[model samples]
Target chain A: MSADLSIVRGKQTLGQRILGFFSRSVVNIILIVVAIFWLIPSVGLFLSSLRTVGDSSSSGWWTIFLEPTRITLENYANLLSNPTITGSFWNTIVIAVPTTILVVLIGSLAGYAFAWMEFPGRDWLLIAVIVLLAVPIQVALIPLAQMFGAIGIFGSVLGVILFHIAFGLPFAIFLMRNFFMQIPSELLEAARLDGASDLRIFFTVVLPLGLPAVASLAIFQFLWTWNDMLVALLFSNSQSQPLTVAIQSQLRQFGANIDVLSTGAFISMIIPLIVFFAFQRYFVQALLAGSQR
Target chain B: MTQTVVTPAARETGRGDADRLSRRSRRRAILIALAFLAPALVILGALVVYPIVYTLVRSLFDASGSTFVGPENYIEMFRRESTFTAIRNNVIWVIVAPVACTVLGLVFAVLMDKIRWSTAFKLIIFMPMAISMLAAGVIFRMMFQESPQLGVVNAGVVAVHDIFVDEAAYPGANIRPDSGFAKISGAIVSDDAVNDGSTVDVPLIGIRADSLPDDVVNAQTAAPARAGEITGTVWLDFVRGGGGVNGVIDSSEAGLEGIRVEAVDNAGNVVASATTDAEGRYTITDLEPGEYVIALPPSNFDQGYQGVSWLGEAFITGVIILSYVWIWAGFAMIMIASGLSAIDRSLQEAARMDGANEWQVFRRITAPLLSPVIVVVFVTLIINVLKIFDLVYVIPPGVSKPAANVIAVEMWTVSFGGGNDQGLGSALALLLLLLVLPSMIINVRRFREERSR
Candidate 1:
């Protein structure tokens, strides 16, 4: 009887194992299918960019497998030779780099003050920062356009950068201050006891400890400025338009110029994609930390 | 060393010196902090705070900022049909996009654990987060083209359609002039009724010779009709060399196969029907000895399966919203997955060991535990969608732009997209701010709660 019971128990375990395997495979299949679905749009764009103009217009991008010779670098070559697209590529760097650096410098100082220093109405100012975090960029667009016009910087790269800095600060300061608060007060007091000035303490102690947050913020701000189109559309002129505005202008009314559009769009996308992958850890960290708070 | 014996006056004097020194240091510290914060404060005060106040003031004034409108722009914004359409589209976006992204994200996050290649899957889904809204707009715009040859979406739709439904053989075929037939309501009908045992011919024009289906054979003349039967031939009337006579089925002309021919009586009922063969000859036999109309139905001339017009006015907003959801669902997934990782595993294991299946454990344990994160994702998405502009701006064609308009686009259009009505634009901007304010408040409150903990 005991032997019979053992055999039955073994059979039951085997059946459960098979059931588990089946369910697990189902989950994997679902996830894989979903991932492919997510990838099709971008993949389609990439393939379309590689095909010659005549070929892409006549058939879907997926047909390249049937005629592999149809793919070529001609579109990329044409895109590079186009002065407008290349100029806008340069314009993107001109706008994004300064915007990132200025936001970080100014935001770190303000965040340090808010976190470590004792000043009048500190809490009220921090509350103001929090409130500003929720304010959309549209509220600032009309008035700033006027302000930039009055200052004679309208439709210039400088105007776009300044706008980005102003809007990027509140969230930057909030994020940095929160990160800075986690640093023990003892460290700052130690530096102070050694006759370090407030500036020296901030530079040596606070900034070093806040590297993760700073890195995250830098990546976040860089991508934000690089990917921005609406601000550039409203504020920048044809002479100063970034790759996004340039691409938008090229989008024809009927029958898209697939060659110019696909190539230019891919060009605009490649840099951010590289930056994102290289520092994806920090990017994801920033996203997770930003949302949790 | 000198002996120390302090008088009360000396001690009090020392205390005063120390107090004065500390007060001066306090003053200096305030100045230093101000110095650190000055640039950020100036920019924020000028750009964010001041602009908000300026927009409010501008909304109350005329477009040129010289005359006081006093809420006239607001009233005008409400009265405009475009404004109502924009508001309605925004409501649809808020209702649809966020829920779609969040639910898909949750399901993806939960199922990812079951796969060995979960990281690869996550990366693929998260890849779009790096793409700019403008690039995504361009990608989707091309993907949703109306023609199957140009758009992958339509290509797939057309392929699937062809599988279940027979395509029309001749889309643009029509009757030759004076061919004893006239197009009535898109059908080729005989101009005069014919009795049984008579022969009829429908020689069609308008189809190019090169465009004809490859299997088409040379037209064959129908044999003389037997008693109580009607016979006919439907073939391309025009010859390739341009020497064939009008309304006559020449020997060289190719037959238009699969064209349906019906014998209709006076009451318009289809009495008998036949489909043309490769030689374009169809015959109806055993008909009563009475007059009947030989007609070709409209199905024979249908432009077969043009696929969906995805960029048309009806589907424009939906396509744009689908693109938005595509870009954002990964963000939601990553966030919720992080929250999922933080939950205690033993609770889930305990539920599983207690005879619950995966769905039960998910519904009873995982979903309930993940609610806080889910709510955060949902509200964040709500805030994001309210100001959505790029996809709406780029994906729609010029004709469908009005249908896909949201409040943000409306604001831009009124002020900058050639309308030049800044007063009304400011009002629209303020309206958007008000719509987004509630979700932002919820997010800020959640931040505060998280911080206090």
Candidate 2:
């Protein structure tokens, strides 16, 4: 895309080039300023996490540059010492992993069916998936909570994981089905000529071809489940609540325990940031897929 | 003659075999699709579909789920103060947050052009999109703290303020009963200023002993003012635990040391000004005073910067919205930036060549091109903030949570956050769903449009 954008500039005169240079420089400067503006708050949180609660409360995080000696991992140490928070940190992993795995796994199979198979009621079913894409999770919260309670998975990590995957499937299937449609029908015909069974074809041809979309879907679902607060809050027991819920529970109105907040927030933030940077292209690809909640 | 070669019965048999084959394939396909979709659909049905249907039905019933109440819960939802406040805040959020975010996103997206590290620049700007709204909420709440010692913003407010004006000498200081002064409106004034060559004992009380500045000592009467001048003592007249006299500064009494004394004339103009020293003493030398009110000015009672109450009723919604904007603007920016990247550059170049400034090119060519993505981002944010449970629930302290509630948060609160009225909660949830439905529909339509294109 940028290659095409760069190609738009051609056969420029000296004056035009110079004017363009200045304009480009101005754009660079503006973008740099906006980037800095955006980075400062998170940087502040990071810096605060490195300092004592007392030091953090007394002065701005920006001042840490002048007093570099004040930085410590005391907050992180304190967070590790607390059982509830550390428990929830582990619970975050327990919840997010299965949800991501199941969504991608189940979504791809369903996506292949919708995209490739000449099944009855296919178009109407696809439309159903599309319409379901817009159903706000708020509409489902109360009754699901009630239903979960009735069936006794209400406060369990399984309940939370199941809830995330359910809500997560529409977009996953949507993305996967769309991506799968791009594969040519000739490939499927070639496989069928050799008398390949449907499951056999799905496992061999469809799943392998669907990896890029699957990767995108996995990260999207993982991040959603990892960063989730509402579902975890509603469904998880105190013991099973994820890090986000834990961090939220620790927030105080006054005399905010900044140490816990800064450290716990950092702890909760680590996985998503790691996954984002690790799978940057996939993340953006999935974002462009634009079925995210 | 060629058509008469086959019998009608044979033709019917052949046609029946083909029909059976297609039917068998169709059934097989349906079975495969069911296998693939059944898990996702089952969970979706149990968690998403069934719950949605149940909420609609549940909302028509009473809290216990036994009685059919028929819209009473909907009326009751609005009648409750917290739920009503939540609706009001949701309306404000729906209007303000999306526009603010989309505009910011558009500006950032447009401005990101022609830069070499534009990608890196956007990576940083879009970084917050990776952050959980819960974390973002905590960050902003800390930033908007009310105390200069705590909140970065109020600290900034104090830092900027301290640059222009000096802080108060004695916060929460006031005049005592036995002092030769009485409180007049806010400022303390003496009946008469001392004549030249006389010492005025302007004793003070009511200040805490420990609150006195460390440099302060026992009050001592000053030597008589030189001719045409006045000198006085403004010591704390009362001693700790009742040891000193009320009218005069005893040896044990610490000075009411930091009071600002102003001598006001008949015209209410300050004739002289002095701040008391460590010994609770001040001298206005070279005073040609026939009469003056020796006033303790209001500066003495100054209660240094009490930072804004961020969670207070007036600004809680704004603070919550600000946090919402913080977390989401990055999302809007990244999506819009991608859209910007895909825009046809020649149109913009053409506009530029035709005497268009950057703004004009953006307005005429770039903006209209980017409007589709911008509207999608806007409507997406509208859908997001409508179900804005996390930030509102997490950001505001418990005390301010009610005032900062959105409909989603209200639904949670009524059912589970201690209100214990699931029926009202179901109604509130339905209201949020209805409120969000239009934007959701718009978003879905936009998605379909994008796909179709």
Candidate 3:
């Protein structure tokens, strides 16, 4: 009886161990599968741009590994030489950079005023800006286009840039104000006591401390402006059309020109990828700090 | 610090607070604001504020760029099929896309968070968010190609059938012998035509197959010959062999022989479809009251039934809601997660020691603390949804084909897509502004309240 009981006990222990191992193994496998599922479409998109049009149409992008000889860089080369899309790459940078910088600078200042200063109609003015936030761009386009045309900036790069900056301000202001409010008012008072002018104190104290918020705002505005197509379409002229517009024009309804489309799309998307990665740490930090009271 | 800074400015504009305001200091503030904000304000007022006013005024007028017709546009909008259809599609997009995007994004985020290279995974999933909507639309369009298999998807399906199906398995299959519908080889009969087989025998060989209608034969033969040239067995063999016959299948295949015709009503169908032509929209010809689906052309069968249902308005709501939720969910989750993480660790530890379970502790302690975060997330999501444009314009479902189109897309359609319907567009824009005024007020008021705390 004792011998039989010992054997049964041993078998039960082994069974339990196997169950635990398989359960954990299944979880790890699932995690990996999920990761691959998320990555495959993007990888497919990237690979499709590098392949010849025949191969792209003939098989799934994953099939490239089965016939690696089909890989080609001709698509990218063609895209670069394509006249219709060339200038928009540079135009996007020119537009995104200045707009991002201006939004950061002006937003921080306005945010400071809202956070620390006690003035009449301060709440009212801020409210007005916030209300503007909910107003969809479509509602504003026709009138704004007319207004821009009247002012002679319609269909111009400057006009597009101005629109992005204006739209970007409310969110920027809201975010920066939240950041400034968290700085412990005593710190600002300490800086003021050091005999610094408001300008000096602002440059020295408020600005430096708001770096995370500034960084995140810059990243947000950069992504928003860089990826923007509707605003660019509505406002930009041929000379000032951004990469989104250029990429858009490549899409022919009946014609299947995957070569130029994928290549141009990749080029257009690269800047945002770089910006996102470079400032990624700041994204998490700012999201944690700026979001909460 | 406050005293030291206040002393200089206070003395300079001493009682300037009350009216000791010197021209220099007041002018300085004005100039500074002008330098910093004038451009933005002017641009905003001109582009955003003014257009909205224009849209409002325009919507009240007639289509000829003429005088105020006062809600006539709205009435016409209700009356017009296109406007109503557009509205219906927009609503479907808004309702469906947001929830779908949000649910998918959250599931992805949660699943991805468990992975070792979480950020890398995020970058990949978020890749689509970076690509222009036009590109996505085009890519999906190619993925949905139709018959004859131009698209990869259809090609793949056809390739499977070729590999699996035996050539001789179904000699009596429903497939037509020729390209035309009339020449089907199966036993099925159409309402319009009946077969009356009459044999004409030829003296030299046998009954000639060419004497019959052209639809019955593969439409590649050069011309018909005299009767009694070939036996029935030989003709049947010829039909099967033509496909795999001597290197030239085209030579032996007959054209337009053995033809039949069928007539059916063409009512209740989406006869024509379009893509956004520079203005970013496509509409099918007026569909009858029935289940109709119109996907992007060239690849029609790739996606599942994205059916446009009855009362197109519901579908438009679905689309709008989908887009709204999809775009805003990430922001919502991020805010809520941040809020939850901000809770004091000690409170939880103390509660655990007091025999409180995780659920009780979360409900009692964490819920109250997270309220502020929840509010911000909800408010931001609402305001953002109110203003979002790209997805709405890009992936319009069935309903938004007409009048129920969102204020934003409506304005664009009227001004741009409607071909110089600027006045109507401007008037709609103004109505949109009025619609969003409440959210804006709430956002600003919340900002103040949050700041004070």
Candidate 4:
């Protein structure tokens, strides 16, 4: 895309080029200023995480610029050593992994069915999925909480994972179904005519063809479950809380120990950020797909 | 015609067999589809659909979910002040946060197109979308602390404030006991009025020596007043080593600079006023000979400008919304930026080639074209803010929780955050659903329309 723009720019005459340069520079300056404005809070969090407790409370994070030696790894070390912090981090992995796997697995199967297979009330069920996409999780929270309690999975990581999967499926199925709709029916029909069973055709043809959608869906589900707070907060108990819930618990404590808070928040943030940037293409593609839908 | 004449019985038999076989396969396909859909359908039914129905049913029940009390929870929710506050704040959140985010997003998206480092700029702007609301709440809470020393925002605010207006010079300054000064309505006034030619001494205490401004000079005694002029020295009476005499300037004492000293007449009007210098010396020249009470007005002892109480009851909701916008604006930006990229650039170029200015091009050609995407972003945000929970639940301090409450947080509080009233919580949840339903319907319809197209 940018290559095309540069090629277009090369054709401009000198006067037009100069005028464009000035306008672009003005835009550049504005963007830089806004970018810095956007970066301040995260920078503050990162810088504070490197500072000592007393230093964080006594001065703003920007003060570290004046005193370079104030930065330390003590906060991260302390946080890593804490059982609750490490435990919650592990719990996040436990919850997010299963939720992502189950959502993708179940959602793809259902999506394939909704997209290609013949069934009674197929259109009606698809419409139900569309409507379910609009259902806020709040409507289900209380009853689910009770249901979890009754089923003895309440406050367990399994419960949180289950809840995530349940809520995640609607969107997952919706996204996967939409993506699958674009797959040429001839491919599926050819596999079926070759004596491939329905499941075999799905695995042999549809799943392979739908890899991009699958990748994006997986990344989206992983990030959603990882960054989730409300579901984890309500569904999980102290032992099962994710990093988000853990950090929130710390936030509620008096005096808001910045060293711990920043460290925990940064820790909670870095993983998803790593995942996002590592899979940046898939992530953005998924976001655009999700929004366009 | 002769060839087909005797084939009716054979054709009927063959047609029946094909029909029966087709029916069997159709039934098999139905079974297969259901088999594939079973897991998702069961989970969705059990976790999503059933729970929604159960919540609706549970809302009518009492706290224990046993006894029926229809409409009572809804009535009680309306009656409660906190519920009203929650609803009001939710309305404010819905109205303000989304528009703020969308407008900012649109601006960033449009401007970003002209820049060279657009990707980096978009990354920074959209980075917050990756952060959890809990983390965002923590960051914002720390960022908006009241003290300039701690919070970067208040530090900037205080710096800007001091540039425009002078801070109180001698905040928390107080007169010594038995110093011939009386505390009158927060001001330190001389008990005895002085003639024009008389010199006065106003010795104050209560300021820590270390807290004084760095440029403060040692205390100095005032010179004798000449006729038609009054002179005075206002200095800290407390010495560093505690050896100074009460109400007397000591060599070790520091001057209270910039203290506004007013001389009031018997009729209570300020006759003359002067500010103390670095040496705590002030001279009221051209004063009348009549008796006048010298006063250190309360403004001198006023606590200097502390930055805004962002987490206080008055501003908590706004602060929460701001934090929300901070987190979600990037989502809006990225979405809108994608939309902006998808727009037909030729239309914009043609508009520009015409006599249209940039603003006109944007307003007429760009915006109308982008309205669908904008509405999608807007409606999505509306639905999002309606169920806003994390920042509202986390950002506000306990004292301002009520003020910052939205229906989601309120629902959580009632159900689990120590309220222990699930019925009321269920009602609030239902209310939230009802509130979100319209936007959801709009969003679903938009999705359907987009898919159809």
Candidate 5:
């Protein structure tokens, strides 16, 4: 009886260890498969960009492995040389930078007002802002384009900038307000007791402590404006069109030079990815904040 | 205005100071609040609120905004076929795309939880989210291009297809006009029948030289018929630079490889059949001495495998949705992964400790805990796909724009994309807003709930 019990006890540990090993392998396989599926299209595009025109038309991106010598930077060089592409790249910068600055400025200010200041109708206004967060940007497009046309800023980078700032405000304000509301009241009271004016308190105390929120807000605004297609499409004219619109015009239904497109797209995507990596910490925090909201 | 001069000492003596100080401070606070809120309000009011209100009012008017249409545009939106198609496509997108993306994300998130390379997996998967929709659209559009030479997907398919059932080498290659054969019921049938011991020469033209398979060799005339076999040479009648005589196997002509030649009797029954070899030579031995119709079936001239016509009218919406999923699935994964990590590990451990299998633990403990986050991601995606103008507007060709049209794309087309009907666009925009409002409300409520948590 004792011998039989010892064998059964040994079998249980062995089974558990085997179960653990099998589960681990299953987990690895699943993750790897999902990873490959996600990577396939992107890898195809990247390899296509690296390929020579002759290679791209003749073979699949997968063949680059068989003959790695076929890879070249000619597509990238040629795309960068195009005057229109250069112009649009500049246009993207001109739009995204200022829009980021304005959103952070206005959001931080209004957030402070709603969170700390004593103002009647504040609660109703905050609710309105929250509701405004849900307003799809499409609802505002036609009228705003007309308004821009009426004001004579239509088809200009400035026109696009103003539109982004206008639309970006609600979410920025919501984020900033929610973030500031979490700041303990004692921090502001301590400043007030030291004779700091409201403006000084805002600039010196709140803004300093809100670096993570600001960084994330800036990253979000920059990405949204930089990656934007529709707003730029509606507002900007040919000369002022951003890279998104520019890359779009390059595409054709039949026989587009996909090599040029691949290069241009990578060029357009790299900056946002850089910005994302630079502020990845803040970016993830912002996503968390956005989800909570 | 009452007792105006009674508080002259209250300002300095701390007598009745509380009331005056409180009232003044209250007024000052309002002024400061307004000062701070002015920029945001102005922009939001002008660009967002004003336009929305303008769109609402404009939606009620006629195309020129000169006539009072009284919701006619709204009603007419439902009345138009293209617009109705757009609404239907939007319904499909809302129903399928989000669920696909959300489910993929949840699965990925749960899978990534047990792996050591979770960060790398997340980065690679989430990488598409970094790309612009315009770019992603371009990538998918190229990948789905119809030609195997152009699209990677078709090339992969063609490669796999070749491994299974062999594809026709001379697809769409047919007999030239006034040639020996006539096309009847899509098969090339010879007008003359031949006896069992006779030799025949069947030459086909009208296929390009480059399309010829590499194994194809110079045409060789058939040898004299043996005792009981009917033999033939099926060679390309056309030659390079057009020097070959019609219906004759010239020295330069390459053989039509792998073509099926059948011998059928008068009552339309196949007696014997043989496929052409490398030199276009074929023979059916031991045949009865009877008249036969030589037929080349239509399978010999089928249009070869072209990859999917992604931008075409039939499949544009699907391709666009696929691109959306490619981008958003990663987003869902990242969001859900964050949510999953926040789940109490001890509960999962306890469940496992209590003899529940991994799947059971996931279904019961993990899923219930992650349900709220999943709902938020799904709702967010629904809201997003509703206003999906950029991809829809960009991906489809000019002819197919109507088929792939979602409401936002329809709105743009009507107002700006040459439709020149702002009133109709505004109505469409308003309809989209109404459609999206519930999801937005749910999202905001979810946000508030999370805050309360």
Candidate 6:
């Protein structure tokens, strides 16, 4: 990539050219080294999962290249059959899917309300949601858990999903509201002018335009729920533990199990990876969504 | 012509407003908003607000789990030497981790700009972040595991010694058989005393122990561990041994006559922990350690009894800031970088034409312009960090370290872990809310400012 750089100057002086050449080479080398440094641990993890237990235990993962003939898939095979891990993976999906759907669903509706609906105390409600944004999840866990217990959702996947949705909605609504508000008032005015209801204007003109924000929200909420363990652990019973909780349980009291732990970690990574890649563009926007200009 | 068009238009608009039921509709809109917002508001209020209030109330109580001893708990918490240690450690964690991560992340992002495989690199660094905190804890535990070189890190150490140290000196390089953090020299003895002044036999556990030849074991005699020489890093070895598959060589086996385990909470005050079982496992409950969450009670009517657990509620208060920072800083950095990159090339060119140097151009032109982005980043980071949870809960084991803990994890521990002290948890949670609510206010003000602009 550095080799394809566009030169800064059309006609460079002698000293300038010399400095540029040295600077570029040094910068390129540093960048390459950094990229490798940043990536090595995760790559090492991937490779460790792929290799046989014996190989992983004996040498540094870097040493595997020297003994290319020793690679095996036994660890992955064992991971697949591991009942706890597989169940957790399934549980994670059940939790993440619903949580994402609800956050997006409720958030968009609330977004619509804040954007178009001319209600008294509308600004106050939006502020309240914004205020609610800072209610640390930790603070809510106990009471929320107790609430779930009373409602018969404690130790259930639904309970976990509901908790995630509740926490996720404030930010989700903020994101979606901003996006919806960006639509020119004239557009909605036009729709209403043609005898369309507010609901129809929302479903037709606004939602289509809010796709970018919605897509980003879905990606974030999905990843957040998918990766969440604290809520799941607190809310879900052992039978319904998410992949993170399950993976944590697989952590042997003594030390990490290379075979099981790596496989479990990789399994957890699969969905997040898929989500990120599938919505790569949205990922960028979502990363910057909540910040002010 | 103008009057005819204007009069009809006015009437039509008024008719439209009346048909839509302006006054009645306004009331209806309020009702609809209340209905729509009721679920989230009620839930947040119940779960978040109540617990924080409960925790504050509970912190005033005596350890017997009853009695309101106003400011006594806080006084006692501060009086303990260990409390000071915990506070220091937490301060270190807060100062070190975030700043380090942010700076490192910024540097990486800058270097990664326009690089090949930048996305791939980012995923790898971020991979640790995606894994559960509990999982990361376990992974680090494994890496730091001590054994007969059974843990990856120790194994590497042993390998390095095998290559560098003479074979005679490397008798049992893999096995750090001593308990605590010290090495004691004695003859390896089986069943009784071996007064040998030279070789010591330590029956090492873990895989590395398996490699020790029987001859070495027979030749070596066990020795008493020397005092005063044990160091902190060596203590890490003992801690590592405690968790690894390889059992730590018991202090008794080393002929240490008496050993007592004294545990301290983050406040550094000694707290009673459950005695270790025959298998050496100890479970400590009500250890107000680590991060926690604070929330209101589940239902509005039940707010009479706020919920707060000592450890659970308190931990939540500590972590609220940290978790928020981790989540929002990524965007802050990205936006900050983008804003920097977006400056017009012509501006820099114009500066250069005026004989200004690059540094001056950046300081004068770039930074001032980027102020808006920086302010945005700061506000966003403050709000986000205030709400942080998972990272705090997942990183530290609250049982051993309390002071270093955050509010979120503490709340969880207090609420769910054996301490069902919901009232105190609620109080602490409310404290967290107090900290976080200001950010929301700032955000709203900013939103209004932008809208007006």
Give lDDT per model, in order: 0.87, 0.79, 0.57, 0.86, 0.83, 0.57
Ranking by DockQ: 4, 1, 2, 5, 3, 6
Q: Which segments of candidate 6 are over 4 A away from where they belong?
A: A1-8, A52-58, A291-293, B1-21, B25-87, B109-332, B378-404, B418-420
Please rank every candidate by lDDT, starting with the best: 1, 4, 5, 2, 3, 6
Q: Best DockQ goes to which candidate?
A: 4
Q: For candidate 5, write residues B260-287 as lDDT tens digits.
A: 8888888899888888888999887777
Model 3 stretches with alpha carbons more than 4 Å out: A1-33, A57-60, A284-293, B1-47, B64-66, B105-117, B144-333, B343-388, B392-407, B434-445, B448-453
- Write one digit per residue (lDDT tens) for candidate 5, span A67-142: 9987899998898899999999999999999999999999999988988988889877877787777677878888
Error of 5 at A185 (Å): 2.2
lDDT of 4 by residue, A1-293 (tens): 67867877787789988998898888888888888888999999899999999888778889899999878999999999999999999999999998898999999999999999888788778778877776778888888888899999999999999999998898889889988999998888888889999999888889999999999999988988999999988899999999998888787663558888999999999998998778877877777776422
Residue B34 of model 6, lDDT score: 61
lDDT of 2 by residue, B231-266 (tens): 788776776667766676688877656567776667
**How does model 5 score by TM-score?**
0.85
For candidate 1, give the docking quality class from DockQ.
medium
What is the alpha-carbon lDDT of model 6 when measured against the actual structure?
0.57
lDDT tens readout by residue for model 2, A92-118: 999999999999988888888888887
Q: For candidate 3, write residues A25-58 as lDDT tens digits.
A: 6655875675564454345567878888877665
| Predicted candidate 1 versus true structure: per-residue lDDT over B1-453, tens digit per residue | 112333467457778556556766887899999999999999999889999999999999888778998999999997998999999999999999999999999989988977889888888888888889999999999899998988889988988987787544576778888767899998999999999999998988888665566667898988888987888888888877689888777778887778889999888788999888889888988788889999999988776787999999999999999999899999999999999999998788778768898889999999999999889888778878988999998999898999999999999999998889999999999998888788767766776787699
Best by TM-score: 4
**Arrange candidates by TM-score, highest first: which order?**
4, 1, 5, 2, 6, 3
Per-residue alpha-carbon lDDT of candidate 4 for residues B1-453, written as tens digits (9 for 90 to 100): 223333456457778557556766887898899999999999999998998888898899999888999999999999999899999988898899999999999998888877767887878887788778888889999898888899888889888987787554566667898989998988999999888998898888888665587767898888899998889899888877668778778788887788888989999999889988889899998887799999888988766777889889998888888888887788788888888878888888778667688999989988888898888788778888888988888888888888888899889989988999999999999998898778767766766677689
A123-218 in candidate 1: lDDT tens per residue?
879877877776778888899998999999999999999999998998789888888999999999999999999888888999999999889889
Residue B42 shift from truth in candidate 1, angstroms? 1.1
Residue range B190-211, candidate 6, lDDT tens digits = 2222121211222322223333
DockQ of 5: 0.55
What is the DockQ (computed on Cα atoms) for candidate 2?
0.59
How much lDDT does candidate 2 score?
Answer: 0.79
Alpha-carbon runs more than 4 Å astray in model 2: A1-26, A253-256, B1-13, B163-303, B443-453
DockQ of each: 0.60, 0.59, 0.33, 0.69, 0.55, 0.28
